[model samples]
Target: MSNAYTSPIPIKRTNLGHALASEWTKIKSVRSTVWTLSIFLILVIGIGLLAVANTQSDDYQDVPFTVPAFFGLMLGQICLITLGVLVTSSEYGTGMIRTTFTASPQRHRVLAAKALIFFAIAFVASAGSILLVGLMASGAHSGPEAGDIAWGGTVVKGGLYVSLLGVLALAVGSMLRHSAGAITTMLGVVLVPAILPGFLGIWESTQKLGEKMGDYNAINSLAAIFQIDGPDSSTGSSQLVLLIVITAAAVVGAFALLEKRDV
Candidate 1:
């Protein structure tokens, strides 16, 4: 008679949780994640404090107390973008993607896990830094002239905006599968629209178009959110909606390509 055989390990069906756990592990174990996020914090908090320290209470007369954080975030966002690219593209570079796919055959689940994990990390870091800076600025510069700035809205929207940019960068990285290329494309996505409007304004034929672009570009959107450029109705909601649509499209494209491609 044959002896009955049984395994000691428990067997279970895999789901999104498994993929998320794997992604969480990978993200936390990597050094790039630490370095990029650390720099992001330093740039945002450091420059924000400096801006607040250099100014007097009267400086809040026309703008919100949160305005100083905008200066730091402009530079700090690059670090987030870089981290986003690295999250996806670095695995491809090291040929770790094959193992990932092998372990999690449901490719879209893997992607969703990456996006969710990265977005959460980026959003928390961004919001925390912005809120910290805003509180410090408010303590230093709050006055009647500040006009009851909405600090809560500023922090939440600012975090969402920056986190979406990083998510978009992750989508681009997934498509390009190259860290440097994806980072550069994201930078151009942010900078070119903001910069090109100025050059275009020099030409009479494109002046209106340039003005419109300048009004709706990322910089203007972010500045509007922080109330740094004063109150504006046109820039804030529309720009965020545009970004959401574009990022959704990019994420869909990444998933479609992931299913069709060899790797």
Candidate 2:
């Protein structure tokens, strides 16, 4: 009997869900993620404790919401940025992005998955940090705001603000596409606008521009978000708006880059 010709069937390609799972596994597997998160937890909680220890209460109203938030930021931003840089850039660093692109050719899906994962990570970190601050600040103090300490609206807003900062970093990382470049840009974006005025001799220019820049700077704007009083048209709204607009632009730019740039 003559044998019939036979052909092998091709393997099916995995869907987006599988790609997401694979990406998640990559993120969780990184040592930098673990270390950065550990340091973030310790710094946030430790700072809260330190702030409470150093605090002298005249009136509960004296306890500025900005205080503990700053305490957290002192440590949180550094480590959070580290994590953010690693999230997307590590793949580039390891040449894993090629495989990732192969698996999920829709670049937007990769970014969306990364954003979702990083957002969740930020939320958990913020919650822990806020809870630590609340616990530390729960004791005796002065001012009509004594009741406000435990239920302080600032803590809630502060947590969300920190989460957004993480998102901003991720967006930035995507735009820069290099870990060091991303980090440098993040620092410059936060610091340069505020610091330049202090050094420049252009007093008149600095005042107008400084005030405007101050309004738009990320650090300044985040300070607004974490402020007890909350932000309106005044104070740091300009800075906050600037940061938001920049973040939006960065995300859009990242998407465009991913769509066109060879991974």
Candidate 3:
């Protein structure tokens, strides 16, 4: 009734939590999340059980006893990366990103929230499957010192690897703004290094560099997480450093583009 009438409801300033909640809802609501994660879990658990059914005496000589679970996880990683790319790229594909930006108006915050949520979900699923596989492997066989193998450390590292890979995929998606392109790029990044090095082996002078590339690649990082030992083996530190550095650079580029480009 008065000229200076107050509002009935209070307005609260938004923060990162709001963004996170939004991303969580979006991720959960998507069919891609369900399909991709379902496939990942099935492959990891099913392959792990198969490995347990065929546990060999020499299997754990150089690798952790739970190493069989990694075979399925290795294949399942592609799906995780696809989901990561789709998280941002699909929005761009269908123009949902405009709505997201309209609601938030803070692009970087949105990206951060998406990355955090995806990382958490991917890590939990990967780690849970790996742990279940490890437990199944340990108990499935009654071999001597079955429970004494280095299971915890390698399993944890594998989870971290998958989580980091998902983050990298998300950053790539934000930069490319195309799901297919970003997914292809992620696949190349993960696989080419392992194969390219072999081609480079023909040149004697380049052989060392090629070997280094293979050892430092994303595929090798999965092996490193398994802590497999041999001349071809690598530790997680080098692979993690390489992948994280590239992902960080991509994320910075994505933020820069967000500011310069119109929705």
Candidate 4:
């Protein structure tokens, strides 16, 4: 008999699929994921129904049936943002990232996996909730007067927009490596531009700058996607393009930092 021995177990090279599976497991197994998503569902669905119930048939004349969903999403997105930060920052807090990095030596792959998985979850949840609300609203208020209710457009664009925001939060989390700090940074990113414009408007010299910022802030971007009137003439496509550019830049920065930084 030969002295060499081989084990019966088989091994395969790891790839993005393996990383994705691992991330999926981690995300699903966490309590924070469950809680945050639960709250998001409640806020989106509950508030949407309430808004619809309070409205008259005339309310749908100008706005799409899905407009009510926007109100709930405005608050629900905070939950997604919080969840996004926790996805990465939680691991760092508990020192679990070391093991994750060891299991997947390619840091970029791990981050990519996280981003893909998170985006899928966020998009599905957001779109589903919006669709449910839209259907309810349409059923309750659809009539000849409700002209051109673009609920379908709202569902697709609204979902994509919210999902990108979550991914951006993930990038911020990865770069910051702290939960509270990353969440705060994202909140500021969302709110500061919107609020700053109001303050800037008080001064004549900065009024134009304020108008420019207000036109492009997160609130206006979201409102435009929902087919609501905003301060500026920015179309949904323009706002989405701007968001995509910002998110891509943040993701690139996260990848670069992950490569250079020690675990």
Candidate 5:
């Protein structure tokens, strides 16, 4: 028989979809994803509901119900960041990355797949939870004085915030290849740059620069999207652009490192 007729196995080129499936399997099978996301939901939904229960209808008279949801999400960002780091870092920790690279042989493809899968999972979960809490908070505080409920921008923005944070963490993990080290770096990414400006603001010489940093910082940008931050309309756009820029840079760095570094 000819080769075509006699061959029992067909050779098919692997693509991103296959990689994504593999990554999805990896992420789902891991305990970190479960524990991190579970705590995220509890903190987000629990705090939001608890806040609503304590507040009177008079509270809604001046504030939008979306406020409480944003509050919960702000604190829950830690869970998202941790999960992101674990996605890639845990593999390195357990020496599974070598096997993964051996199976795929295409490093960039694996990274991209991981990013897409994690982003989808994180964004959907966060957005859905925020919407649920927002609706519930609105109902609990609804009255004639309760103004229009704008959940679209806030929900999407908040979702993107957490999702992008996870992506950043993943990128950092790939570069560092250590779970603890990457997690610490990311915590600084989320915490330090945001507050350093405040400390610098104490010096009159640096006050202007500090104010600029404060205005463009991620947390303030997130708050600005929820309309609870400040009068500056530029904070939202500035923060969004900053995140996209930083994430894009990290992604490039991750791919470059993957090529140069040994598994």
Candidate 6:
């Protein structure tokens, strides 16, 4: 009698592409994604419609041009942040993070894949919200020419800005590892600076500091990507400098901690 031996097939490690696919599937399957996106649509589209309906100007002349669209942008950004938090924090919530790390040892790859997925989701939602608002606004007007849909660099950049903010939120969730903590911190990032602006205004000594700093607060900084006459529009170079510095610090810090910390 002869003995026969067989070798088992080699298992391949999950690559970034596979990781992205897996993460995308998990994201789409979650009930949370649907809820977040639904609420986002309601607030953005609902508010946008209201803004157009209640416009002080009955004619197209009454519209602020960008006000209807901007209103939706502002509200849609919140949903982006929520989705961002979920992308990473949910793994921690369900204790699946350990498995994720086991499957993909490179933390950078995990975060990178997550951010990419989140950006794609956010961009689609944000862009769609903008387009819907623009359409609603156009329908509300009955002039010789329909209100032009401003698909300018400003609008495109604005969409990108919202997507990046989602990426930022995901990084925060990864760093904090707790949903409550990540959300609270993000709200602080959105609101605290504005609260201090008034105090700075009152204090003559710090007036300039507050004026220059407060006018370009966090939200404004992000919102500038969309504004034709944003807070820093007068000096394009200055706006670019501020945007680069703020965004770089945030993304770099997230990457650093993600690389060094234990999952």
lDDT (tens digit, per residue) of candidate 2 on 1-263: 99997668776776667666766787788888888888887787777677777765633353443356466675577778768877988788889888878777888988978877887778777766776676556653434545353345555555656666677888888877889998887777567876875655367655777666665555665565555353332344444455557667877887888888887
Estimate, for each residue in 1-263, the C-alpha lDDT of model 5 and write its tens digit.
65556666988899999999999999999888999999999988899888888877766554456677777777788899999999989989999999999999999999999999999999998988888888898877787766664557778888888899999999999999999999999988878869889798889999988887887766777787777732333326568778988999998999999999888
lDDT of each: 0.89, 0.69, 0.84, 0.91, 0.85, 0.71
Residue pairs with colliding backbones in model 6 are none
Misplaced by over 4 Å in model 6 are 1-13, 56-66, 142-151, 218-245
lDDT of 5 at 180: 95
Q: Write the per-residue lDDT of candidate 4 for residues 75-155, one digit (tens) a residue.
A: 998999999999999999999999999989999999999999999999999999999999999999888866655569789
- The clash tally of candidate 4 reads 0
Off by over 4 Å in 5: 1-6, 229-235
lDDT of 1 by residue, 164-214 (tens): 999999999999999889999999998998999999999999999998889
Candidate 3 wrongly placed segments (more than 4 Å): 145-147, 230-234
User: Which stretches of candidate 1 lie above 4 Å from their native place?
Assistant: 1-6, 144-146, 232-235
- Top model number, TM-score: 4
- Candidate 6 at residue 52, lDDT? 80
lDDT string for model 3 (1-263, tens) is 66987899998888999999999999999899999999999998899889888876556555666687788988999989999999999999999999999999988899999998999999999989999888787666637634345678767778878777888899889889999899999999889988899999999999999989988876677888777663245557667767778777877888888788887
Worst 10 residues of 4 by lDDT: 227-236
Q: Residue 223's C-alpha lDDT in candidate 4?
A: 87
Question: What are the per-model C-alpha RMSD values against the true structure?
Answer: 1.8, 3.9, 2.2, 1.9, 2.2, 3.7
What TM-score, to 2 decimals, does candidate 6 have?
0.82
* Best-matching candidate per lDDT: 4
Ranking of candidates on lDDT, top first: 4, 1, 5, 3, 6, 2
